[model samples]
Target chain A: MKILDIYARLKRDMNYIEKELEKSIYSDYTIMRETSAHLLKAGGKRIRPVFVLLAGQFGNYQLDQIKHVAVPMELIHMASLVHDDVIDDADTRRGQLTVKSKWDNRIAMYTGDYIFAKALGVVTQLPNPWIHQIMSKAIMEMSIGEMEQIRFFFHTGQTIRNYLLRIKRKTALLIAISCQLGAIAANAPKSVSQKLFLFGYNVGMAFQIRDDVLDLCGTEQQIGKPPGSDIKQGNITLPMLLALQEESLREPLLQEIARIQAVDGQTDVSAFIRMIRGSNGIVKAEAMAARYIEKAIVALKDLPDLQAKKDLIRIAHFVGNRSY
Target chain B: MKILDIYARLKRDMNYIEKELEKSIYSDYTIMRETSAHLLKAGGKRIRPVFVLLAGQFGNYQLDQIKHVAVPMELIHMASLVHDDVIDDADTRRGQLTVKSKWDNRIAMYTGDYIFAKALGVVTQLPNPWIHQIMSKAIMEMSIGEMEQIRFFFHTGQTIRNYLLRIKRKTALLIAISCQLGAIAANAPKSVSQKLFLFGYNVGMAFQIRDDVLDLCGTEQQIGKPPGSDIKQGNITLPMLLALQEESLREPLLQEIARIQAVDGQTDVSAFIRMIRGSNGIVKAEAMAARYIEKAIVALKDLPDLQAKKDLIRIAHFVGNRSY
Candidate 1:
């Protein structure tokens, strides 16, 4: 059960999905084609597609059966980034200029819409009601998560429970469904698909907690985002939520966040980074993420015997335990 | 067939569809629910939903059959408006404040995504692939049309053909699909569905051309938008395109447009309105709209012997011949 083997297979499917995406996005309007191409070029890890492929392997695996969900799920991820960029007032993504940065905000927004429509068009080509239901529900959850983020912004009394829920919906929910839909598309037994979905969901939870950690502790060069950028943007992730819970640290922490808000993009972010890290919040956050990873591993016990299953287990470990 | 009777029927259907929309859009994220509720409050003519219902009558005419199309078609229309308002920097719609204006552009964008997700979710309740295919394609076309509009803004040498193509995709294509999808959902004969689709398509074309006319000549009291606002936004619609064709008027008209570009929300608006109305462009544009209305009437020749069909025919004439 080699992780490399799973990576290779997922990459192959991603290439096919990528080509389909390229062809489907073609339009007589040159700007749509151009802008979509630019956003696509800001490549993602294709993690959702990988989950789709890996989940399919637990059942009657077929590359063709899985590509429908794999492609559209990935496209959904891509579509949301354009809108997210506008919301975040982000200048760069994945070390490249964002869609809104390169073009005006309006064109970037419509480009997101154009990609979303293409995704829906592409997925409905597959003859399955359940697949559409799963994918569309994932989109709904992701949108709600986004709205929640906007609502919670600048709220100093952010609870750890609410933070976890927000992260699950915003970042993990779609990834979870990517796996579940793949299994369903491949005609896996409902139980097998459901187990895989649970595994995916738990891992997604752990993955986002780590992302919050990386935003606070990892160097800007490693992650392509400024350290403490989340707090600056008024997003209180799990780490910040945990840090805010300590009464001794509360007032200074809130004051620092206030200063971050008052400062422009070039504010001294490193001081806040050190404060969060040194307060023992990161350690507690890591332990919480580990619990989710363990839960994900337990969910995998129900899967049918396959090397793909083992690879997924390893990927979960890799996501939660990755140091750099 | 009485137009009032047709309006009554449409109003009933719209009320039910609006309820469905409300139920589908609500989420635990209360902000998403409330923002979408605000957006739905900006009442529209429900023209798309009406087409969906009328077109379904061409098939196995049933209230239930038409609703599946009508609800989603209207939701899709509303979703587009949410995003469009953001793109257009529009402050109002239907004499009410726009979503982007009431909430920031960020909320408007997410609210659009939320509605789009809900629309796609609702459509899957019907077990028909063709409905999804047609509706998805319509959405894709709408996005591309928006791109074309953005790209062509303020370009002086733009032709009438380019303008027509843009509006055809932006405005006409969705209405055409609403008709086709409604019929398809009801299991209407393909030929009848095709005829209704063509009828709707041509009428939509005339509807937009007449809209362009009103944008150039109608008073603010008659139309919510100020006259010549399209040109103010740098979109060279049919009236301006026709005016641009004359050798005597090209440079002076372009100078007027250049002045439009230099100003943000104000210009010598009254003089420009007077100039367009006084020119032969107004008459030529009206003639072009009339052609499409006649074509729409011809497209309805094959509709069934029903009161709904007769009402649709009258609505086409009303849409085309309405001077205000």
Candidate 2:
């Protein structure tokens, strides 16, 4: 089934989460309200919230109980996006002006901080110290991951292991906790929550790998931003890393990267994009993504035969195959 | 009862907190560790930790228990300072280069975020959900106050009430919670915690008012940064706002402010500083600070006569009178 079908199934609960997200970001200040609402309007797939809701289904599912987890999951994701746009010096995200671009970097920074603090505010209402602990640790790891990305920019010497670890912290850990926290909030069995965490973690890894692959391969319409944004920002993604390892492509690829770096990525990167697209790197990265999807599916094997389980398996496949 | 005397009394417990503060910011990432360590080394008065420790004395005071609240209070303050330096475009803070100046803005931003997350991580170790709720809400208010400061920058049309509300969120709420959470963590009586919160809030208001006054009146050697930094950065502090209300200084001060704004505050602000100092603004602001201190002392009237109460009262007086 398509992602839309899954959303359709959880439509009512998703609406509640959407409303909570709006409520959570509301501010008395006009500029803050406007900036935060602008980000909410330029929305994403809300994948984290989806994972949260689905994982909640594994326990005593209650929309009231689950939303506290779901809303913060999305809010944390939104907060990171605001900060990420600032760090990347990105003008637009998802085809709209970023918080930094529309307002200023300082405003964007505070907006992100506001949203993040608001997220903690929502989660703390749950009275579960474990959720607070897990969420805070995840946030810390994500910040470290962000710093690592900056440190590794244009440094093509990084290994695949380095990339995996960074992405795990950056993307997978939050998703993993979304599932775990959702389960924990819903009073799921510990063993079930562990399985869900593993499932979500693998799915998140594949999702990011697919995203990196799409940055080079997808059109602006497909990805919601310019193609090769990763290369433009000197973010050496999985495909590019794999491409650099190819004997035939290594020297020219390095030179192309050097050329991009020389201009501070101001010049056209279509040539570099074309070169990578023609190489075996895309296939290798796709294979890696597929492997992650398989692992995700394997993780869900011991889970109860619920509709949520079936939906998760399909979502994993879709994540691996999705172009956007 | 000097601030140093209070520190001397709490010296041993304070040292444990200092060590914990160091331990909390530790990261496996080299740059993260270095940047965080740099901020820690450029220490402030550690006033928040002092408040936490002093407030704990009214309870079942334990170094180990109170350290959790104390460390996070200081970390949150440090995180806000790092971000504040970015907003202020400040090269130095407290006679040392700021995080943004030493590294880049992006790194500084991440370092602030990382430190803020670590603060939450430390705080959540306490299973008291109320502590989390209060801390999270205070952080939210702090961010809002920060945004309001940005919104009101160079805005000469603002009122005294506007300034007071902004400072309340920016300074007082965190300090209030620092005391409240400390009392809570140590299982202080609710009445005692409430009293401490009031004491902290009023003192914090006085503290910020005094700080703003010092920004204009004190020397670079005394304040550890250049005098008139507030006007240079378009932060219309109490003295400037009070001076703006003066009939004689109004138009000329507006002109000078316009001149500073035109140059984006790059020009020397000594003339503006001299104008404010020569006006009644400084004395009026000092009087307002003294009033807040009186209220702070009054807040402790019903509290049990303990050394902590006397210390709190002394700290409030010092905050009002402090030159730096």
State the lDDT of candidate 1 residue by residue for A211-298, as single tens digits: 8898988887878877777877878888887887788888888888888777643477677777788787899999999999999999
Question: By TM-score, how accurate is candidate 2?
Answer: 0.98
lDDT of 1 by residue, B193-291 (tens): 888889889988998999889888777777786677787777888887887777888778878888887885367666666767767898998899889
State interface RMSD in Å for all models: 1.2, 1.2
> Would you estimate the TM-scores of all the predictions?
0.96, 0.98
lDDT of candidate 1? 0.82
